[model samples]
Target: MAKKPKSDPNYKVIAENRRARHDYAIDEDLEVGIVLMGSEVKSLREGGANIAESYAAVEEGELWLVNGRIAPYAQAKTWGHEERRKRKLLASKRELARLWNATQRKGMTLVPLVLYFNHKGLAKMKIGIAKGKKHHDKRADAAKQDWNRQKARLLRDKG
Candidate 1:
């Protein structure tokens, strides 16, 4: 008989850059791997990480994650990991080239949208290839959101 695979545990998102969606017009997205030490991974498992201030940087043909803070593990040994070290993102050479070219345009950037663990328990980053939105665009988005909220409330009240 074939054995069934183990079910995946629920994902608990530690932190997210919600502002990314409102501030940028995300045109495309890609999943990328992150480099981390043992303690850093442990910290992430505990949901004590923040990517709000983080941004992806391309330098010397390599992609790096900057400003992402994974707090040091409390139980780690003396030689624990650095909290804000520049970690390399693992992506195919072709993908790297594509992102590099895309970022060359003014006001466009690669932003981390979300952080979560895969079914197999590996940490993953959802990155968006996006361009910055102007002030009016953000105001319009806020108004739209408010309208949606009011519509939902009215529908509930009618029921």
Candidate 2:
């Protein structure tokens, strides 16, 4: 007999942009809904999504997710949605204004952190307002991580 998968009470993550943390200093994060076609949703359920190179932008008073890839559903045939399309993001007027204002600043950007399905089975995206990191900042972060790992090892040995 096959075993059933365990159910999680929280959201289920479909895709994540791990590089975003290394490339930017995130200031804040917000969860927003995404408009997706039926085929796209089916594909996502099958783990056919990528947000590593995707970003969100405010255009014409609305937020749009760009450069994200939701692979076509094999069963959909000719009716499959485009792999890379600019999908609309659902946000309130006040939230849109805030995102727009924040993006107007120099060195700030809207980056997609993760794509997931909420407990209600609705797709949502977690986006971050971030500032780009410099080369030195990345190096420093790497060194700090290395030192923390070494310190942990030393403590383990001593204990």
**Number of the top candidate by TM-score?**
2
**Per-residue lDDT for 90 in model 1?**
84
Q: What overall lDDT goes with each candidate model?
A: 0.85, 0.92
Lowest summed lDDT across 10 adjacent residues in model 1 is found at 1-10
TM agreement with the true structure for every prediction: 0.86, 0.92
Alpha-carbon deviation at 136 in model 2, angstroms: 0.2
After superposition, candidate 1 runs with Cα above 4 Å error: 1-7, 151-159
Q: What lDDT does candidate 2 reach at residue 66?
A: 96
- Give residue 39's error in model 1 in angstroms: 0.7
* lDDT per residue (tens digit) for residues 26-135 in model 2: 99999899999999999999999999999999999999999999998999998888899999999999999999999999999999998998878899998999999999
Backbone clashes in each candidate structure, one number apiece?
0, 0
RMSD of 1: 5.1
Model 2 clash pairs are none
